[model samples]
Target: MRNPSRTMLYSAAGIATAFILVVAVNIIAGALYVRGDLTADRVFTLSDSTKKIISEINAPVHIRFYYSKNNPQTPGNIKSFASRVEDLLEEYRMASHGVLKIEKLDPAPYSDAEDSATMEGIESQLLSSGERIYCGMSISCLDKSQNLPFLSPQKENLLEYEITRAIWDVTHDVRKTVGVISALPVLGMNKVQPTAESIASGKFAPPGPWIPFKELEDTYEIRKIPLDAESIGSDINLLLLVQPVGMSAKCMLAVDQYLLRGGRLIVMLDPVSLYSIVKSATDPSYRETVSCNLPAFLNAWGIKFNNNIVVADMTFATRIDMPQTKITYPSILDITSKGINRSNTVTALLEKIGLVFAGFFEFTEGATLKKEVLIHSTADSMPVSSFLANRPEMLVRNFSPSGKVFDMAVILRGDFKTAFPDAGKNLLRKSISSNSAVVLVADTDFLFNDVCVQFSKDQFGRKFYVRKNDNVSFLHNLVGYLSGDNTMINIRGRQTITRPFLRIGALKSKSEQEYKNKILDLEKDLIQTQEKINNLQKENSGRYSKYVFSPEQQTELRKFQEKSVAARKELKNLRKGLYGSIDRIENTLKWLNISLVPAIVIIVGLSWAAAVRRRSSSK
Candidate 1:
């Protein structure tokens, strides 16, 4: 037999040993800066771009993080986000090899810390209870400083990118210049002539620059290039061409020469530009053009863009709810991860992009340039007439899957040959090297402010724009990559924190498709029935009055009514089945979550007890 005192002593010693081991491991981990990130995307792990930026820092950078930790009125979510910010900053500090210093400050009301935070331009969040909280950071490198007024939780995916950009900004001295050439007023209206009636009514106001243009201005110097300019300035770092319509031959040659001389270019073409239509509605002088393209340049480069045709994808159709009915507008695409090329750094982190009446590109035979598609439509896509883009209902009714994938965006890299080979000897005939690149996007309306963002006001009545999707980020990434700021491109728009149930999503999509097909069949039958009724009435025109229906007409009408009722019943059943299936799956998941761990624990406990009993009997 065993002594009870000895058994108690052994148990106590084992517990003590486990506690000591946990403490020692934690201490060693802290000292050695060791961590494990088991997430699939490694969200907690620092990106290679971030590591590279941190490693190159020779000057000491000081980061001051201010949070109202002592304020009881501070929100719980803000506190949690602040903790995450601290952890991320700690990681940065560790990676910087002592060059990055972080100081955490909790500013109380009317304290010196608060005053310091205010001086650094940190924005304070005012609560409903008349209290203020601070959750911002200020980074300084020698004399240069950058302030992030507030760290918004909604922009969590961009947290690392923002921090790295702040560090880079303070260290860098020069800002690159971007040249903008757009048929639309992207840089705001140049001159607004006040009409006599508007002057009397005091209601005339010229539109401002696009939101994306303003965002670009914050990071780079934006130069407006005229459409009729003879040459593109050499000082322009990157050329942004949006809706290149009404450009003279000389201007086209200038753009071609710019590309041939190793200049980076991003062109945005559209089969149907809704923005132009809207502008025409407001400004009578604005000429409305449904399509725009750089035909001369694209044809020479062995890329074909049909300005009269718009891409329609059933798989990526965006559903729009109208006042009368709901429609899945095939012309308006919502490209998801499957369509975005994940291997490309410029588009890897972007989740979704919205495009209106977008076009597609095709590579001609014997194309010499190396081409990579950044975004494409699904196989269930086809080209439709641009004229039908304004009529969503008709477009949906006539849309058919072509079973061919179309390229929406592409990156071409090579030594581009001049489109104007017969031009004067002063211009470049070919690129100096094979490193030049040009990015082409099929749609330009996605960058419009109304399509990509929504207006919102804060508690202090300050206006801000909230992103509707990743369209703005996609543009930023393109600009960053082309301008050789690859570090920021890598870290921007990282993996989303929400892990969706893809299986459930697939099931839902399948069910919705089935229901839609049924509805289409019903509509077709209704149309046929109406046609038959009309034919019968024509045949019996002399035999029956207008109000009184003949036997054959009455029979057809009754049959149509019965079919409509049956369709309604079938639709109801389909909706019920869809919800029922989802509910069943959710319940099963809930049960597993509640019982699985406890069940495993009980089984292990019983197994260990039985083993101990057997060992005791053997002894």
Candidate 2:
């Protein structure tokens, strides 16, 4: 009751002190990084293999970020973006359990460290003349002898992955064994394949996920074999088989036994080939084409290969020429994004990927199957004869009139028991029984080099894009998914669409030279006709030169005019006969580009992204 003013003063001072403490904590929190993963589907989330590498780090890791905070490239406007990048790295550091450290360095006063960033492959563009800007990073593992991939600290979205992968690689030694055997060469030098040299030379080409596995000579031992080779090694963790043509029954059985031993298997078969150089327009090489139908293990797993055909619809087709809307026949088979499953890891985060020249498979209901169509034909698709695989001539409107849809591609799987009655036994050793699951695909042409090369240009006067099919991606995911182990050790990659120019066709020898000679003959005929018309006009130059007239000169002009007109008409007809619509091919491609590719991308991109995200989240 005494001294009320003094009591009030004391309460006010206490309130002020609490407020100051709160403000101080907020500032420190802003400086420090915490995790805020709002993404419903963690596509940007660390892959299982990647996560394993990071969790296994036994020593402390340090990452130094070298970015000029005041540089033109690091404008105040984009500083928020930079801060986000900084925060992401901090999250990795936090995830590392005090084993990760990050140091921010503002390159000061023409430092030599700035030069090192460029040499380490951190790309920077010039914001102004003579003013170059770079954002660089160096990752150090506690171990001195381990190898790590270089990373750009500046990029957004991928910053977390970049930093974490680099840290894991440098900190821990990756030592997992993978085995490969395929019709398409990847584990070997691949010189026997078409783009082998280009792929080998690292010509800025798209990388197949299998390349890293092939390059693991220093860490893990790699074993290779032909499709016909029998008996896979027992110690192999993953086995790959691609486009096995005329493999002996024993070889196929060997693969089956390997899987029976709980070994991972990836089989890439095809219903029909889109790009086959089978000696002619009518080559009978369906040996692999028809034979690749997965006979035993597929049905055992409750999956079905219809051995049918697929055709595209107007809704899903990509146009090669818009004015003419010349679309590529069979070249563009539209798959509904619904074909992708949100529950599967392989395609959960996939987007509108162009599997240029692919086939689909279907599943039966008899077995305990969890069937997911990774890619499917649109409702507008219909079945065509497999006989038409190489018929480029069928790429016209007449071939695909309207209204036809069918299912083409599928990914079928489940806790498959076995195709063989006694499948529990191992491939090389009878003591071990197989518990490994099976994953199979019905397309093989997409894996070949020529099918994947950018063979033509686009309508924008740009080279057409050719992203090598996820042939290798499909294989790597198959093994990783089936194994239930994240240490597969070789699946970090990016692929972009490719564009190629038409200026580099091969020179023809005699037989093909004869075709060009025929074209030359047609050209000569056209020239002669043009010359004759010119000469005829010269004689009557005064009257018919401009050719504006009344009736007065009718008789005199008749004979000359009739001959000139007839010659012109004949030459036009002859040109049409020789070239047919071949000349229109270029124009058609232009039209297709304008009308088809963009529309296809938009429709597919939106639909596909939604489904892809769904799948990614479940994984």
Candidate 3:
């Protein structure tokens, strides 16, 4: 009834047509369409800020991407990451619309590409097989150039920001100026000759510039403003005031005038500066108890910061483990995501920030400025005397939750009126034709190296710092926002791309909490049992011999020992149960992942064959 030859020819034609259609569609997409990023955080998607920066490019910029594609010794992860980097560069080139050119080079062993990479300052990694792999980039525009010597996977979160910043830097010839005013030696103290006693004590080395200050120096022209300065230069883009102590009225007036003239200011006030106390041990001229505030300016600005009060948050306390005891220092806080404002671009991507002896801020009555809290403590936080900050045990013993949140960092934007309005000649009484912004951080010691980073030395004896938290990133974000580099601010410190197993994490946490409670209860029971045994022994010692225990005492001691063993067994069982449950879940997930797709495909295939057979029989 059917012509098999004609049917076969039609089927072949349809298949060929479909294949050609697919090929044409792919070719058109490759030419006209940018690939979509479906990740939850849009990890591969170029952000709007990045697109904006790319659209503003007027001149031709070239990016030389050096990658070791042919090297067998290169790790699989590095190769995958390089592929992603190449895709990202392609996105940039597409977005630039011919303004940005990307040149991908495989610097094989002893090749000319390798020499070019070396000359461009791209760093190479040595493999176990003694082969070097290059994976970095150099950006150039006209006469300007910048090199990222090494592309580290650990810093992938900041990859986009770094690349965008390099592009901006090469295009922009002039660096912005930042003025620093501080009582503390943030710009590094000059080296002093070590005395015989100092050398013997091994505590006389002069410290270099603070890490935050040095980081700023790499990007901006840092000018150290004296504490006694009568005026600030107009050329300064931003003024950074850190731990301002004993400022003269004239200097305060100068700061006031600068703010009133629409200058951006970041003031780091500390209620109790631990860094200052440490420095005082080495330098007698430094204050033993350092507290800084701008009372005059704060009053005029309708903000309140009590220099004598330090904030203590039970929820965000940092734990210190000692040989004798483990104490939670409430004044030293490890601010988590709950404490940061996720809606603000400056702090959105920050994971954790460490602060020592931080204070809190409050708005005064009828405040005119628009206030936003960038970072704050929880409802279980309270203000305590600054002097009690160092006494961790005492603070923990006496801490009372205030049932109210406290602002640790705040931003105020408005037409700010000057605190020195009565001053004569050439001084602004209010912000000139525009609103000004001021960022107030409650602590300065967080920016200090002791709290922010861990110092280390490599095998080559090169000194480096490993950041312990997001303190430096936080500072950089604020500075970038304040200095009108909003593109970098938006791109810096992206959220981590890894998606964790939240359900498993929750289960583990619940198990841990349960175990902790059980341990506490067992310890309490053991303490009571021991006390009873001791009392019985003391009472029976007069009637019986010292070495010989009474029946009641022996029974009590036996019960206590049995209880201790039982507690141990219970804890062991609890741990075993937790692991067993996790393993079971993991195995189920593995099987599901391995078999689900194939099972569905098989079922669909059987269904289609059955339907086809039924139709043929009916025919």
The total number of steric clashes, by the backbone 3 Å criterion, in model 1 comes to: 0
Off by over 4 Å in 2: 1-57, 67-84, 105-134, 144-159, 171-174, 188-222, 274-291, 294-316, 319-331, 334-336, 362-374, 387-434, 445-476, 486-619
Clashes of each: 0, 33, 0
TM-score of each: 0.83, 0.56, 0.75
Using alpha carbons, what is the TM-score of model 3?
Answer: 0.75
Q: Please write out the lDDT profile of model 3 over residues 263-317, one tens digit for every residue.
A: 9999999999998888788877678338888887898789999999999987778
Using lDDT, rank the candidates from best to worst.
Answer: 1, 3, 2
| lDDT of candidate 2 at residue 84, scale 0 to 100 | 60
For residues 1-619, what per-residue lDDT tens digits would candidate 1 score against the true structure?
A: 7899999999999999999999999898877855689998888878888899888887999999999988898988888989889889989988898999999998898899999999999999889898889999999999999999988776676689779888988887889999988888888986888889999998988878898788777678899999898999988899999997888788888888888777899999988888887877876545545578777778777899999899987777877657833467778888888799999989988888999999999999998888999999998778988888767656666667788999999999876888776777756665446578999999999999988888887554456667777888899899989988777776766645566565665565455555666555655665676676577667666744653676776887788767767766775665577557777887988899999999999999999999999998898
What is candidate 1's CA lDDT for residue 457?
A: 74
Specify the poorest-scoring 10-residue window by lDDT in model 1.
Answer: 505-514
Q: lDDT at 317 for candidate 1?
A: 80
Q: Rank the candidates by TM-score, best first.
A: 1, 3, 2
Residue pairs with backbone atoms closer than 3 Å in model 3 (clashes): none
Q: Give me the runs in candidate 3 sitting further than 4 Å from their true place.
A: 1-34, 184-213, 246-249, 274-290, 314-338, 342-345, 348-354, 386-400, 420-434, 449-470, 493-495, 499-619
